[model samples]
Target: MPTALKLTTVQGNSLPIPGVESWHVTAKDPAMLVMTDFHWHSSVTVSENSTIDAALDHMKHTGVRCAFVIDGKMSAVVGMITAYDISGEKPVQHMRLTSTPRNEILVKDIMQKMADWHVANLKDIESATVAEVLKVFTDSDVTHIPVMEKNANNEQRLRGLLSFAKVKRLLVA
Candidate 1:
């Protein structure tokens, strides 16, 4: 005979996403929120061909909601994958857009392409304090922003990533 399983519950206060709306800034002190001051989402990455399930696993272990989709080893960051991208309507949209079955969908299919994402310039990120990066969140519907840096070749390279959660957590605190 086996013993019955047991579970317990814990309670805590919740942090709310700042700003009344996507374009609004309801935080009392937006200046205290700097993208650099917060953690960026560039550490964990996944291949574009990885399945949504795989991306989810990576995020789960990394404690991040987003992953930069890399093409290959040391490759330029191509796209981004987030929990929302997988758990949200993106998969359904991908199915509709590509006529692919749910099982056939890959991260690449639903990832926000490089061309579709707006980024903060590395220089601006280095110089700007406060929640200037909040505008990136406000201007777009995305919770993450891929920051780009222009290198010696005058080409934009993947620098880091910013997310709305980090900004809002600090701002609302």
Candidate 2:
């Protein structure tokens, strides 16, 4: 039978790891790695009330794959529309070909709700090693994860985004 081992965090917090010794000391932990800094791409935000057509135009202008849906001070990720989502069916072509204006289709009509999507906060992500993060990307259906920073008031604010492609590059490097 394989022997189990216990791991601890930098603060001597015990972590559960089966059949592994000093698991916290492994390369998977960010604390053990030399690279502590993580980079993020600028966030593309849109109002939940905005039309899908408008959102698409904004996405094209920004050249980003996803956009966060915001409503006043209460911001939550509504849904993410990727190039593939807009492509394949060629909605743009159909819109242009038809007389229907783009503004008619609201983002709420198309955006996936927060409850329906897989989301992770910075604190939840910070504990993960690069390999672990990569695993999340591979295992999950989502391609992008929004990174949030806690403000002085203890409110989570969307700071930036982490892309699976970028994480993959870092891992390979």
Name the best candidate (by TM-score).
1
Which residue pairs come into collision in candidate 1?
none
- The sequence of per-residue lDDT tens digits that candidate 1 reaches over residues 83-154 is 998999989988898899888789888998888887777677676654566766787798987777778999
lDDT of 2 by residue, 61-97 (tens): 9876677777645555555655454543445655666
TM-scores for candidates 1 onward, in order = 0.69, 0.55
What are the lDDT scores of the predictions, listed in order?
0.74, 0.61
- Candidate with maximal lDDT: 1
Error of 1 at 160 (Å): 1.4
Worst lDDT run of 10 residues, candidate 2, spans: 31-40
Off by over 4 Å in 2: 1-42, 72-80, 88-103, 149-154, 169-173
Name the runs in model 1 displaced over 4 angstroms. Answer: 1-42, 72-74, 97-99
